[model samples]
Target: MSSATNSQLAIRTRSWMFTPATRPDRFANAAKSQVDVLIVDLEDAVQPDEKAAARGNVRTLLDAADNTALPPLAIRINSLLTRFGLDDLIMLLDAKHAPQFVLLPKIESPEQVLQIDTLLTAAGKTTWLVPMIESARGLSVVEPIAQSCSRVAALMFGAADYASDVKAQPEALALQLARCGVAAACAQAGVLAIDAPCFALHDAERLHADLTFAAANGFEAKAAIHPSHIESINTTFTPSAERVTWAKRVVEAAEKGAGTVDGRMVDEAIAREARRVLAAA
Candidate 1:
């Protein structure tokens, strides 16, 4: 799809569920889930010996998926530096149907995004990109990376990998800086910023808490490792009635050329933000 077309169909992508690309049987079930995005993961999720089989399985699944109305489909390829990444790209080029996006894992610089963008262009594919920031280096260069690719639709935090990289607690304040950096970078580039998946599947309460924190910190969506977490992620990202009302009021004031709202001066910038909130809802 063209970049404009991709943007128009972009769901806020509240919850993205990762399904192992090696398992074709699970594709149908994943497509029927409530998750905003279904990510066919070829990295970490698949064994090294199964790479070839996984690629073939993903291709078959995508072929069959053409007739189904699915949540936005994405595939998380292994890092471009890996042998699996090259194989995955070659296989994707031969597929009858391409995924809506390719999630690049362990992205650490703008050069990587540009390199992939060049590769995609040369292959005559319009599949958009979503970079997964997993290291401190990735977070540091996120802004340039986001701006480096016109086809980039979002920046996703790879929290599990990031925590491991930095040797810090996942839910602690130490990681807040990196998270905020990613969110700010995405916002500056006018692309969606998705929070990392909460790994604690059994602890729904903690997941909810983490989702809340992510939302407050400017994440528009999150990744989910399981179907059970999709509902809560969706709920957390959705705008509340009060928030919607305020956004509406802000828009109304802007329509009337009013420059103030509730005793505070409002401008085109604030009005634009309000409209974004309403549109997201």
Candidate 2:
């Protein structure tokens, strides 16, 4: 709820759910939902013919709502290469009420992000941007994209689209490597990397398994197609008490300048890792 700059804040992302921007009825429900990030999807979720209407609906909904309490509002705009994306940005800048983040899809290079950032800055808008790395080109250029724009807050994995583009299955190890690549890129840039939504919505066990795998592999957050998955996702990403305790102890010992903990020396690097663990908690 604070308006602090992006760098100073920790945007907790357990479950980021995408709602169809064309469906105004779903907006109110989503605003009250438990999802960490309510992504008003104006791109893939909306039919091509309804893109215009969806954009209008989203603008109206944002205007009408008291979004101060709702989870972060993000508008998933179409690729900047299309007319729809340009229109989307125009409408957003002109509106009285604007979303906090613009979720960009199919980002292939840093130039794509720079284009969006340039437009947003020229319009005198500070809306943050998060890119979706959904293709092989995007994956390969992830590092540059992360460091290119100051407006970028995170990188989201569009696994379904990426898998189709690469002609592979989602659960494959090769896909995991691609996901890790994005995570590492985000980490290097000191930003969060989000995992794509698992398609098996009905299987809670499968969702938990996937969330656990993602958490272990350095993904700070995971997307959800359904609200039902939010609780599990949140629980999975949060640090355990045991982990927190260990981190605290390490930090405490390292603060003494030079000390040994359990037969190992606690140095500056160990202290830094401990602080990171506490921060994640």
lDDT of 1 at 255: 93
TM-score of 2: 0.92
Model 1 clashing residue pairs (backbone): none
Give all candidates' CA lDDT scores. Answer: 0.83, 0.83
TM-score of each: 0.93, 0.92
Q: lDDT tens string, model 1, 1-281?
A: 33322136556577789999887677778766788889999998999999889988877766674645666789999887998898888877777777878999999888898888887887888788999999988877889987877888889989889989989987667688888888898888888888888889899789978888899988888998988888898888788898899888899989999767777677898898788778778
Query: Highest TM-score, which number?
Result: 1
Per-prediction RMSD in angstroms?
2.1, 2.6
lDDT of 2 by residue, 42-157 (tens): 99999999999998887786676576666878899888799998898888888777787789999999998988788777888878788999999899899999888778888899
